[model samples]
Target: MPSDNVYPSSNGPSQVDDTIPIAQGQRTLFEFGSFDHSKIPLEPEEWPVIIIGSSMVGMTLGVLLGYHGIKSVSFDRHPSTAIHPRAALFLLRSVEIFRQLGLEDELRSESASNFDLDAGMIIVEKLVGGKVLASMQESDPAEVAKASPSRRLWLTQNMFEPLLRKRAKEFGAAQEFSETVVHYEELSDGVLVVVQNVQSKSYRKVKTKYLVSCDGNRSATRRKEGIEWQGPGVLGESISINFKADLTPYLGTRAKHGVTYISNPAIDAGFRLESGGKAGFMIVTRAGDKKSFSPDSVSERDAKRYFKEASGIEDDIDIKVDSISYWSVAAFNAERFMSANGRVFIAGDAAHVMPPTGGMGGNTGIQDVHNLAWKLAYVLREKASAALLRTYDAERRPVAGLLMRQAYSRLQKRVFRTVPDEPELPDIVCEIGYRYPSAAAAHIQNPNGDQYEDPHAPLVLPGSRLPHVLLSRDGSQISTLDLIKTNFVLLTTGQSSPWIEAAKGMTLEIDSYSINTDTGTVRDSEGTFSHICRISEGEAILVRPDGFIAWRGEWRKDGHRDELQKALERTLYLSGSKQL
Candidate 1:
């Protein structure tokens, strides 16, 4: 446990004067505060983890860690909300994570529902000619729904961040606003971070076991570490405009034209994002050529001009400009995700960046946090060796690289050429196909076939998230995901005989769920018979705290007890009487 007062001592050279005032006029009201370095007792502080950046990746990491009882701190340089909305689509896997954090309802209530639409397509054309040149259709929504109940939610960054931040704060995460990282040094044991208050002319240094950088494409931490981003620099430039208006009258006749590619000889190419009866729409056009458009440069009048020209409408249309942003599409992967020093790690855009053609940015970042958080908790709690930390890089880097490639491929197909008959859109990669192949995963055999298999495939084997299976228990159909709470769940078939009796003397760390082998009857907490599992003779599977299979075998086998003990030992990192 760390004492609250253990602030960083003024280190070597004074690159920044402590008296310099940070610009706070641009910050929110809640962002005004000085660093509280009061020395407080370190009474087993929740997993002390520090995340830099407060966007989706940062907020997701904070909430997830907090849910697992890990104390987290997140910092962002921005005074208020981000002016530019980057990502707008949240994939199914992300929705599932939200469900785990008890935030699914809030997200569903706030964001636009997936409705019946499964996958969407991107269209490209010259804005002036209003001619469609190409289109890349995504996977069908009905097919995706049949595979899993989860669906992608469409919402802008503006609507999503506030909700996530609220949930994270509710779960005991300390979020510092208008605080920017000035400098960070990786000590042998932990990382020391120095942050400056934007309003007050004060600075504070925080020491934590691990530091995760969720900062965007221009990551200060990555720069400080001198890790170069390798790949194309500026692939293309795009101008995005968000406005509130009613374009339903014009679009109702051509709803199938969800994406209209305006190709005209006079203007640049562009596309439209329509939703909720055109309550709001985002129009994007390539930069340069005869048209002038930049997030910073484009004005309200300019936006109206482009919208009218693209939609071919002459009537006076009321448009409220919410925001305008300029983005440069590029494909880049960090030279490395984990530091050779091992105390600092990069995630989200900091690790890999891609074009928004596929909306893989936020989804991949959330997955990055998912991979890192649990491993950090395990290692910090001493349930696993520090070696587990290396797996973070091994697992996420490849996934990031693959996603970036997929995004680039989508970009190429959408821009330079037409959508092929069998367009290879890496939707699954963005959905759920990522897996960790480190020593931690080595315990289980790769049951899902190869790494390149469709990511949307159901997880049913060891090392994979248990697939959600429908089960009828107590006259109600339940999802397998609902069965596992925030603890290790041991599911067994048949009677709770000697096997259950033999495990009774141990600590109450495991929860048992038994089902009758013959009738598929489930024994709940109240000991009532409810049909859940198949209940076919033999032993059942034991799932780890993180939802991976620990062991499975017949209950009466001689080594069954030994296997259970081994599984417990490995999962909990317990040695003899000493528990990590």
Candidate 2:
């Protein structure tokens, strides 16, 4: 654990601007801090992990790390969660992760269930006329459910972020809003971070074992670390008009659809339901393909005009414009995710930026922190070596790169009417099918080169997500994924008692479960677990803490212990724990 001792460090504010936007709507209902900058402690502080930025990705990381019993402190320039409903789409894979944190019920209640709607994109002349120009279909609900326990949801960032902040607090993460990370210095043992109060301009230092920056695309930490971006930089920029208006009358039957693209000579934009259709927003200007509307220059008259025109409701309605925001549609990946010293890491938009056509930017970031949280916990607990932390960049960077290209391709095809020659993976595959590179799965040698596998037909291969299988525990139905939390798990059939016994001998906290057809520890009443997972009698699959398969093969009577030990040691870098 990192010490809570305080020491003085001198540094100026970061060159990057860290301005806090005004609080919006009922956002203050869930404000993280009191917004009193004078109350900020003058002395330096220390923590195991100090997170920069407390929005979606940062808050999620704090919650995840807290869930693993690791204390952390997060700082954000924002006065509250989110001033605007920035990103609204959450893939089923992302929701499944939320479900793991016991947030499924609250999220599903607050967000619109995509499964209940038509769940697809439609290009229309206007909301009232509904003259279709083009359309795209979403994945079948049945197909999606077969891959995970949760479905996709449409909750705006403004609504979603509060939940994460609350959960993070419940898990003992200290979130200090109106605080900006100004500068950080990496030491051989820890990092010294200086943060300034947005209102008071008071500066304080934080010393942490690890510093994670989730400060969005223009991450000061990433820039300070001199990480360069790869691929097409900024595709374009657009204006997002967030507002609360009853669109049901204008939408009418079109309300069933998830997203609507409004196209006409007057304006080209996209619309989506917010707060479960009680309110909504519009993305004006294709950005990459059209004019870049400046958020500052968008007057109330202009915003109302665009809103009414996009809705085809020129007749006045009670359209309350909440906020106007601007964003870039870009495809860029950082040259590297971690600083040279490896004490500072970047996740979410700081690490990779992709076009929003596929609604992957925030989802990808959620998975990025999910992949990292457990590894940090393991190393902090001395269960794994510091070397295990390096795999976070190796595993998540490639996945982010793949999604970046995939999202760019979708932007070209869906918005621009120009299909890229590069093959694009199906949306489900992009969300959950991505396979970690072979180097991340050091226990496996010469793994397949495929970037992703079909989620519908999961191979349960090493470096792949653990295949979802329905099993029963205490007569209650559960997913194989449910068995995974914050520890390595060894999954095998009832006949693989040798593997279970081998796991028992290890001092590490390795949870072993035996799935059986009729009678065993975990009953596979559906009798499809072995077939779906491709595991037979005497065969076992070793899963990592993050629920990715670390190793899988037939268990040998003479070498079961050695093989399991070797797999754990190699995958966790346990053999290289010189720091211990």
> Which one is best on TM-score?
2
How far out, in Å, is residue 37 in model 2?
A: 20
Backbone clashes (count) for model 2: 0
Q: Give lDDT per model, in order.
A: 0.61, 0.78
- Residue 58 miss distance in model 2 (angstroms): 0.3
Off by over 4 Å in 1: 1-47, 113-119, 122-142, 253-274, 279-295, 418-426, 443-449, 455-459, 473-475, 491-508, 511-556, 565-580
Residue by residue across 1-580, what tens digits does model 1's lDDT show? 1111111222211111101011362312222124344442333332278889887889888877877677889887666544444476787777777776777777876664522233355353432233445555556776664444566776667778887776677887778878876666678888766777767846777788899998777666776667888765556555666666766665542343334455454344444454444544454444335432322355567666777766665669787766555555778888888788898999998888876666787788888887777778767766666877786786678768777777777666665455532345467545665544523543655664444444345444445555444555777755555565555566665564444543544453566666542444442332322222223345656665455555554546555555566666654445656431
Highest lDDT: give the candidate number: 2
Tell me each candidate's TM-score: 0.79, 0.89
Evaluated at residue 27, the lDDT of candidate 2 is 15
Candidate 2, residues 1-580, lDDT tens digits: the string is 1101111112211111111122262212111222333444545556999999888999999999998999999988767776566778898779888888889888988874432343688888887785899877778878877888778888888788887777777898899988877767789999877777878987886689999999877676777788988987776667777677876666666776778888777777888875345677788864323476533556667778787777888767887776666666778899899988888999999899888788999999999999999988988888888888898888889889999998888877766668774677888899888888744465463246787999899868888898888888888999898888887898888654788888988878789988888667688878899899999889989888778889885856577877778778888787733221
Cα lDDT, model 1, residue 111: 62
Q: What is the C-alpha RMSD of each candidate to the true structure, in Å?
A: 8.8, 7.6
lDDT of 2 at 74: 93
Distance from true location, Cα of 288 in model 1, Å: 7.2
- Clashing residue pairs, candidate 2? none
